[model samples]
Target: MQSISSQTSKPEWLSSNLLLQPFLWAMSWLDYILAPLQNLIGYKRMAYFFVLPNLLIFGIFILIPMLLNFYYGFTGGDSILLENRPVVGAANFEKIFSCQDFFKPNTCAEDLFWRGAWNTLTFVVFQVAFIILMSLITALALNRDVRGRGFFRAIFFYPVLLSPVVVALIWKWILQYQNGLLNAFLVSLGLTKVPWLLDANWAQFWVIAVSVWAQMGFFTLILLAGLQGIPKEMYEAASMDGANKWRSFWNVTLPLLMPTMTVVLVLALIRAVQVFDQVFVLTNGGPGTATLYIVQYIYRTAFEFRNYGMAAAASLVLAVVLLILTIGQLLFQRRQEAA
Candidate 1:
């Protein structure tokens, strides 16, 4: 051993250069923190082992990134500056409002963004209303002891289960201008073939309709669960008081299911306003900018135009708007609860 040690100039510390340093240190830290408990209980009694990893993961993946995004939102970011860039307050936001599409001839006649914003709001407003009402009806219908209730539930849920892209593709086929299923069926019934995706008006309508179709299943399922939770005694009591179906729904059912309904409406509104992917696949926000949602515009601004700061700023604005809506919903719900 002396001869072998003398033969090499290598240091003794390098012999145990194991890759387990971090783990060993971590376990040692754990032991030090929990050493007092070892006298009173077992190793499993200390929840640190279970707790530390989850806390570590949450901090690393969620909390840190959320904090950074908030920071980035304020940073006047450029794709060239990449990360941790300097702040240029309010410039990004101003750009979005002031951007004039001067390159496009005849586009001057219309206020592009104001008009696009109008269309987006209309889509969101109508779609959310339709989805909530339709979902409620579907939930009520499926809540009964009718024949093949399970099958009907599955059928409703089926559209929601399909990938958004797949749903979009399916709807596209159905709504195709010439040989589409919809037009073919219309012709068979001695009706005219209609342009579903080619016209601005019709395109807007289908975008909303298909979105409602794809989403209704999931919302229906949610409301159905809420409906089931209402006690049968409530219905019987209402009936004993001579309330009809509509009256019972408006009074007993509505108030009792308000909590779930509140959640459904708020979520649906957020989703509807940020509508993309389905619209992306089905119409790409056009025939014109008829279905061009705010998100798509931001996406194009950021990635397509390499205006990272503007994109980030737009997203922050969208987030703020959504937060405001959510707060409104919460306040309304509180008022409802108080009433």
Candidate 2:
């Protein structure tokens, strides 16, 4: 009876404790300040109040810059100040879009821009496909019951926590043409040193390979989570229907995993499109611009060449592409939900 009485009084004792008094006081003060506002807005409309701060931040940092970028894309000058810039409407777009043969980048007035566009397209195509395939495989392998699974999962995910520059630098050392780890291994095996970075083809290959190695872990984690969320009963049901393992995976797992796969695809595409840091640090758009992507082109134009207008124009193009992709993803998600 005494123990029961103590348990019942414990909550009251904790609430009246000196250590919690300051926090309670602070909360009371906050409530005092918000009381009038809450009364005016009502409980249902209070979500807007909570979101106001984040909305303001997004407007200032993202919305404002996007508007300014669009404005600057139409004007041309060496000056960074918008007031000092001359309105050369559509000229930047014309310069970028003009080409005798769209396939031949050198035919364009802004050949470097065209080159960067082609290179970015090529990179996105290869990188997104490879990353998705590799990530799915890794997730599947790790999802199974295996020895040292936790350790292997950590090992795979450790690289995603690293800085992009660090990942690039690490791979740069490993793949360097001369006096690098891979070259040393080749030399030991009585093979001539292969110029991985010096040759344009090999440079692009290494850049893509390194990028996949660095980022695949993140996607793997996402897919693994999705895989684990599937009900064990679904597989049992498939087996009861006399479906083989492969057939069950195709009929049950693939359909169930489509939403997660779509998310991975869209995110991977966006990341591939915005790829800059890894390529910048790894190859620096090297071997005669073979690996130069659109973001690098914009950076070079804005900072190196002092062509802010052109850079802004290129950025707008990139923004449009990304917006379209995002919209498409949303539509796809909606359709998936409807179905």
Candidate 3:
């Protein structure tokens, strides 16, 4: 195939005005500015400039904060903050590991924060797994040929699009003690109020359940797109080999869905680690720090306690952990791809 060359291509105005007017030396500088602008905005990717202002804003707001966070991680004092800092040289890192406040705490003389770590891990593993599975199932169901499919899919994905605060507030109202909608309904049905958010176990359950409800819809939509792109003939071929629905799904569907699953897994992992807003709104790491995630702790450390340096150090450590986990997943994915 003969390819068109992008180089040596001059606009009609430039070719006519510059070439024919050989005596116009003063106008040459005009070409320097106008030529590039014309090429950029004339007809090729001109809309990209619309994002230029956003890009600048993001650089100032997000990028600058990120850079400052990284810089603060290495420094000893809380340079940008005022509290519990006096240039103590890697003392924070040592404290992060050794301190009884987090990663290890002695509430019952048995380490309460370590217990909280287990609680966080349980939430991460079970909540993420349940949400992913539910989402995948919803996606598969929606991808099928059915009546009112669009309506059903939209209903499922609507909760995900809502702001976290709004969703949390809604859940809060529903899951509140005796006056809550959920408890009221249950009590009306001859059941006692369930204390959904007050009890420790109930709080964890509601947090996970609410999180899954919000999360499943979006992942379903994503996985549904991946599912719809798959050729139907592949499933038919597997069926011809006497494969059942389960076998076809496992053998044909799942293997082809690896790329989508990989994306879902990594995104879920990242979100799981950074779970804060829902936990904050729903549990406030409460009933006694039962729902406190690593992020929630960091948030308290930085803003609540004003321990910015330690918080920065914790944030840096988290970034490193997430990076390593992402890289590890990518390596595994590459191996699967190769195989």
Candidate 4:
């Protein structure tokens, strides 16, 4: 009996020892290197030493690229190499803005850019509004004491884990005009087949809807956390005052959830502005540039058109817009906190 028990335990002990040995050996080397550094820097400043690697990485990958992009925007040439390009001042921006009228895209020198800008604006407005509403509704429903709540939450969140390409491909398959699932279902119900992606109006609508559906889960989770953080006693007090569910939600929940909502709003806006991958895969900015957002415009200009300077200019404009949005969010949050 003792020999049998020893045999069974041997594998488990050996497996743990194998894992532990490598990890312990690595940690000992880390300690040995860090000890000298720690002594040289002092404990209080050791934090900065540890952070130096991340700062270096950020400078190399992010900061340098951003500066180069800014410089590229001022240049004009066929070549992407900065040194080969000639300085063109604000010619690209002037071209983009050169129009008989601001509202008339056809009048502009860079009419495609204007078209993309308008489409992006429309998409952002509708998409952001729908995302906020749907996520809030879903979060509220999931927050309730319902059976299979955890299962349902996971189901809703599953799409967020999917790659943008995968999401587009799945929907593209489902919405195919010939022999698609949705069209087949409609035909079965004795309804006429709709050209979901072929028509400009339908294509634009579905793009926004698909974008909202894909992103709603992440925002829902954020709002759910905010909802969970609210003190239960507030709701109890509201009930004691004879407030109904609607009244309680309006007075208590909305106020407390504003911060989270602001976060979701700004994040959704930024993502919506940068929307390209899924829409590109799904629509390819087709049906007459109806779904051509700014990012896609920049992409086509750079790679397809081989106009690197124009693409860089457009990207700089986009970056400025994003920076403004970020700063606005920070200011809003500061004011909210102060209040």
| TM-score for each predicted model, relative to the true structure | 0.77, 0.87, 0.77, 0.90
In candidate 3, what are the lDDT values of residues 1-339, reduced to their tens digit?
A: 135545557678776866758747646976676578868668456566657889999999999988977656655654465344456667666666675455446632324335555676789898889989899888888888899998999899899888778888999998888598988999899999887877888888888999998888888988998998889999999999999999999999998998888888888888887888977877788888778777887788778876677778778878897998799888988998898
**Candidate 4 ranges with C-alpha deviation above 4 Å:** 1-21, 30-49
lDDT of each: 0.82, 0.93, 0.79, 0.93
lDDT of 4: 0.93
Q: Given candidate 3, what's the lDDT at residue 311? A: 77
lDDT of 1 by residue, 248-331 (tens): 989999989999999899999988878878988999888878788888877776677766666676677788889998999989
Q: List the residue pairs that clash in candidate 2.
A: none
lDDT at 134 for candidate 1?
98
Best by TM-score: 4
Ten contiguous residues with the weakest lDDT in model 2: 8-17
lDDT of 2 by residue, 221-318 (tens): 99999999899999999999999999998999889999999999999999999989988998899988999999999999999999999999999999
lDDT of 2 at 256: 93
As for lDDT, the candidate ahead, 1 or 2, is 2
Candidate 3 displacement at residue 264 in angstroms: 0.7
Return the candidate ranking by TM-score, descending: 4, 2, 3, 1
